[model samples]
Target: MPQARRKTPFSGKAKKQQLQSKKQNKTLLMSTSSGTTSYDVVSVNYQPTRGRGGRDTNRYALKFYRETEEELKIKKEEALKELIPVPEKDLEVNPVDYFPADVSFPKRPPWDFNMTPAQLDAQEQRYFKNYIDSLQASEHWKKMSYFELNLETWRQLWRVLEMCDILLLIVDVRYAGMMFPPSLYSYIQAQKKDMILVLNKIDLVPSSVVAGWKQYLTTAYPALRVLYFTSCPAYNLRGVTSDKAGQSNEDFCETILEKADTSFYTHERYKSGVLSIGCVGQPNVGKSSLLNALMGRCVVSVSKTPGHTKHFQTIYLTPQVRLCDCPGLVFPSTVPRPIQILMGSYPIAQLREPYTTIRYLSERLDMPKLLRIEHPEGDDTWSPRDICDGWAKKKGYLTAKAARLDTYRAANSLLRMALDGRICLWLRPPGFAEHRDKYESCEEIKYIRWVQALTSDQEEQKSDVLTSESDDDRHSDDSDADDDSTDDSETAAIANKFAALAGDD
Candidate 1:
């Protein structure tokens, strides 16, 4: 007590610093405003635009780490004004309403019922603990989550997550955030496991946009690493062989492999240095394609169909690393069905009442222009039915009896078009803006740029050599011309000598 009476000089400063750190950790970077960040203004007036497109309602705002107390209060007031309270009984939105009426919603068993404590094996026991921990940690899971996984699906996922040292979370580059499950992310972190986020369909999005996503994802999940890849054009190169072209399917496939394989993964559990990486993602995220490319061959089944892998399978790549492919799990979606449909989780072929999804797509993308529907009359706005009928007629899809356009076929075709990357449905980063000039990338993207530079240097060298060879060909032609001229003079001299001899005779 006597010793404690002598207060440490720096104790107060240290405690203050500790408190600030804790406070800062809780604050999330929300949004930034270029217009006026001035906190002095007591009132915030948002003048709604009254022009074409109805006031630019889709304008995006940037989120910052923190805002002033006054700004926070203003935001709260605005939010409160906009928010209309609903009865507690009517709070829940039925997910089935978002989907087609024909489609039966996948039933979810009670979370605890799936794996009862008495029925749980040793492995199941571990997964149960992880699940409980994840639920406790994530408030979003508690409120919004609905597990679509059956017992078999849960068991497969549990096994994959349990066996693998690293998880390769593949997400469609267009809708990475939408597809990525927050519960799984929280679960992985809770288990202290490593995850490498693979932004799979990179070709569909611009490199700039990929960089933006990379930066944003890295910021959102600090524990996970990120990478970008696309196997479509690369994996599906028609007949281009290594002998014919230096950059063949083989080479492009290697680049794709390097993109994911090059991600840093290490764990102390693998004392033998052989690590298992589990590939997990929503169906149609190119999980099989990615695994095939990484393995340098099609070890797993590659298909256009989602949920192609019905069960979990492991293929050994090398002594150093192996890939564990689990069935493509569709996690509970809080998002609307249009988003789910667009994400490729829904079977495009079996889509009934595709009008809603068609409308959603039509609004975002200029469907009339894209589908080249020159109407009977000059009309800008077209209904889903109109667009479908127009597309059906253009594509030669007609009903047998009425000879009317088969709108169902046309709708399916349009959905496939978006999926096939003919018509892009790309999404930008959450923090994306048209006005922001400075492009920023994450550490992983910077690493990718470094790898790209190396590959580009090789191409540049080959081009330089070709240029030098062309220059040498020009020099050789000049020397040949000089030699021809010398030979002509010798021939002329010999002819003159012969003429003089003939005159003497």
Candidate 2:
């Protein structure tokens, strides 16, 4: 203590000094008011858009946002505003009602072949910025869900547009109008590229609805060619007894090619050249699945995840016909987030507030009947949350810690079923309901119904065989042999039917 008192300069405590860290001002030498940033620097001779000569870095570069608390609050309010329940009249919705009443998609920016890749990229970026700015300036964008923000993905679309002879604009049958961009159709027309508006996942809707949609689209777009396609077409072949019911994978490819050939040969570029058909659409619309089905093998990976296809891939189906699978590009649209999620445009796992979607789904379908769960409160009243909770209880989806009903898991499971076509909410085209009988009796509808019946019969036969095996296990050996013979005959008959469907003699 005496030594400390003598040595005051070496005391444990020292006076603190106030200091300000220097704030570096980032130079805005390359500032622009166009709302897009350029990666080229005149002084350094480095261009990020051009990238390193051999290595590409722009394709996967996603534009990110830093939202302030105020911006986030505004978004929350907007989202709340969009969660309106489906009206009773909208159960069989007109495709036109869901879209913007008076708005058109932005056209691609003008570019010539003479432009460099860097210049083209920059132009596209600028065009996209203006497009977004225009949308933001208007109140219409709020009606739209999230779209692809990455420039690289759009670049892929641009490449596909320029390279392909025929464009296969795949769309979900449930919401075909929502997926079909008028601007895209116009662009293809201007480019003189033939387009086939493919209505995928036909199994989710009735054949009448499918035929009605096809009729409506063709009538609306007089020059456009529309075709119905489903990777799982087996679901459509169940009931009808037509030669087409036994149509195989080859017939599928041939049907597609026949459509393409009819259009391709009509074009000026159709001279004995390799036909390049570009498969393009919003994500999770079965573009990759269609390609895989056409190829008769898994040439490209497919997932329920939107944008699983990262880049455009070309696969030659025949020596003369090649199909290009473009990565799913979410075109700008006025479709709401809930519809987008329901249409499989958005990933279910990343859904934040799924209750809104549940409400939307509930409004359209009998939730209790669809989910096969009774109301938890022992009454007819069932809210979206109640439905989720009841379903969670029924499915034994519980929280790990509290053992509470996991409504989140239940809601996601319901959404997955909707996406996987287990829970269908069919949206019909305009005037479809008025002439429902006409559509149901159309040749196309009958064919689809036949396919459905055939596939359903096959499924039932398989189930019966499995049940017979399990139930008749204690039976005599003779009974087993008889069962085996019956099964073999049924299997052979099914094979022959499928062979006939495949256009086999």
After superposition on all CA atoms, what RMSD does each candidate show versus the true structure? 27.3, 14.5
In the range 278-378, model 1's lDDT, one tens digit per residue, is: 88887778887776656555455565555555556767777687788877766654555566667777566655456666766666666666555655235
Name model 1 segments beyond 4 Å from true.
1-118, 121-147, 233-268, 376-378, 434-436, 440-505
* Model 1 lowest lDDT segment of ten: 463-472
Q: Which numbered prediction scores highest in lDDT against the true structure?
A: 2
Instruction: State every prediction's TM-score relative to the real structure.
Output: 0.56, 0.69
| Worst-scoring 10-residue span by lDDT in model 2 | 17-26
Please list all clashing residue pairs in model 1, or write none if there are none. 29-64, 29-65, 30-63, 30-64, 31-62, 31-63, 31-64, 32-62
**lDDT, residue 496, candidate 1:** 16
* Candidate 2 segments whose C-alpha is farther than 4 A from its true place: 1-58, 61-88, 92-107, 233-272, 450-505
Task: Name the top TM-score candidate.
Answer: 2
Scored by CA lDDT, what does every candidate get?
Answer: 0.52, 0.60
- Global CA lDDT computed for model 2: 0.60
